[model samples]
Target: MPFNWNWAFTWEILPKLLHAALNTLLAAGLGYAIAVVLGLILALAQRTPSRAVTFVIREFVEFIRSTPLILQIFFVYYVGPQFGLRLGPWTAGMIAIGLHYSAYLSEVYRGGLQAVPKGQWEACTALNLSPAKTYWRIIIPQAIPSALAGMGNYLVGIFKDTPMLSVIGVAELMHTANAIGSSSYRYLEPYTLVGIIFLAISLPTAALIRIFEGYVRRKLGLK
Candidate 1:
């Protein structure tokens, strides 16, 4: 016997996979939103005058970055109940993914912030602009051009990682593929489609990130 690809079966399973991909997109979007805000806070906290706060936050970021994301997902979904924090699979997956990526994104933000020349800070100080004004008006605007590439990379990264949500049974693409394969006993088409679907999304996303990065640089006058 020889292996053969079944176009009919591939077409049949695609709609289910596409529906599941929507869940994956939702997870990535929500998780990235959390990461963006939390990462900014983490980066800014590291810049404050309070050494203890900086140390604690720096170490916490390190802790999250150093560990495997899957373990964090398991801990949040399984262990949280012991602390009376019961979260459904979707909630737990999002929190774990968001926190995991926030640590990485904070480093990206820190690099961007540091890339801003000391002269900018001096100008802000000379103008006597309040810290909030300095950051929101001057600093963040400048830092963003430097940060946009890294931010875009992480957006794609989050999208790819959404498959991990399947482990906890969140019904993302991989999970749905697994279900289809198990029920039909036809692993070949299902898994192949998953790969093609991921490639379809990730490659274009990376290219768009590059385009967006260039746009941001030009808009910020960094080009």
Candidate 2:
């Protein structure tokens, strides 16, 4: 009942929490990968020549961005079944996380893509190069350097947001911590450890992201 810390209970629960942390990492990794790919597609979709397509997609992106992640997760997990998408919790959670972050990441990608000079586009057109070749070869390479910082931020952001996955029954760190606290009737240690664990991972991950951004800049000769 007091403000006492129990090392013994902490040690006992550490392994379970650590194991669940792996699930957290997996969810973040897979969700970010999905966001990276889908976000690019969404970004490119908005740049299309068709006003109808661009307007629709722009509004869709805005809708996703404006809504809550929990609502999205609930939609995917609960409402999906009505549309023949009877996915399990992990699948639904990952897809929901992916879609939620993709909206934000698409904006990041669009900023990076737009940073490419107009002359680069003119150069590609001047050479009579196809759009795919132009983008794959020249445009994307230049965009990467600008995008790395933003992408890195989302990578860490996705990691921190993994706790939301637990609402869908994904056994990630926060869910595991909750389970431990509920079972033992001890909230202090479990919650404290959760904060410590998140801090440990987030700080190092942010530092590594900065280092990676620097490495990318040097590699791309931007620095």
- Could you give candidate 1's per-residue lDDT for residues 1-223 as a string of tens digits? 1179889998999999999888888999999999999999999999999999999999999999999999999999999899888999999999999999999999999999999999999999999999999999999988888888889999999999998899999989999999998898899998889999999999999998998888877776775
Give me candidate 2's TM-score against the actual structure. 0.97
- Candidate 2: minimum summed lDDT over ten consecutive residues — where? 1-10
Q: How well does model 1 score by local distance difference test?
A: 0.93
Off by over 4 Å in 1: none
lDDT of every model, 2 decimals: 0.93, 0.92
lDDT of 2 by residue, 5-42 (tens): 99998899999989998999999999999999999999
State the lDDT at 92 in candidate 2.
96
RMSD in angstroms, candidate 2? 1.1
lDDT at residue 97 of model 2 (Cα atoms): 95
Clashing pairs in 1: none
Model 2 per-residue lDDT at 101? 89
Q: CA lDDT of 60 in candidate 1? A: 99
